[model samples]
Target: MADEVVSRSYCCFVCRNYVAEHDDIVSKSFQAHTGRAYLFSHAVNIVTGPKEDRHLLTGLHTVADVSCSDCGETLGWKYLKAYEPSQKYKEGKVVLEKYKIVKDFC
Candidate 1:
């Protein structure tokens, strides 16, 4: 089987603003608190909220809570630091997924 191409767009459910295209969605995954979500390769016009330290076990690193830039609804997060020299590429990636946004119907 092949991966189906999603030909439509998705938006924040609260704001209905264009955030990501189907091709931008990198993959789908699950979490204990939020269940299923889609990780986008790129996110547009979003406001990343205040940065904070996370991952107590691995030592604290920076992250920001993400939100729709227009309506201020909580979306997901942006990883701000890998906390190490080699893994810095993890920063600036977004986690706005199916649970946080909806398919743009219009």
Candidate 2:
């Protein structure tokens, strides 16, 4: 029999709603307001709040709070605009706190 490849993903810790695929992870060394976070190229099953400019560890960035659509739990933020040129790559990406999500296999 051909072996099947199991896909790994990250789910909302509060409701187990799949938010991001493991393959979409950009960085696992990001820092959030609470603790460590992961930068993802894309996120699903989430809703973005109002955009605001916040001075983060990196610099000033326009971000929007991201929450799980299922349970309305604040998961993290999505980078809308990065003021610093070096951080521009983060624009349009989502960062989900490590503690706010759980891993799942399928």
lDDT of candidate 1 over 7-89, digit per residue (tens): 78888898787787877766676231466666566788788888998873334558787888889888777768878766465
User: What is the number of residue pairs that collide in model 2?
Assistant: 0
**TM-scores, in order shown?**
0.73, 0.97
What CA RMSD would candidate 2 show? 0.6
Score candidate 1 by lDDT: 0.72
Worst lDDT run of 10 residues, candidate 1, spans 26-35
Best by lDDT: 2
- Per-residue CA lDDT of model 2 for 1-106, tens digit only, reads 9999999999999999999999999999999989899999989999999999999999999999999999999999999999999999999999999999999997
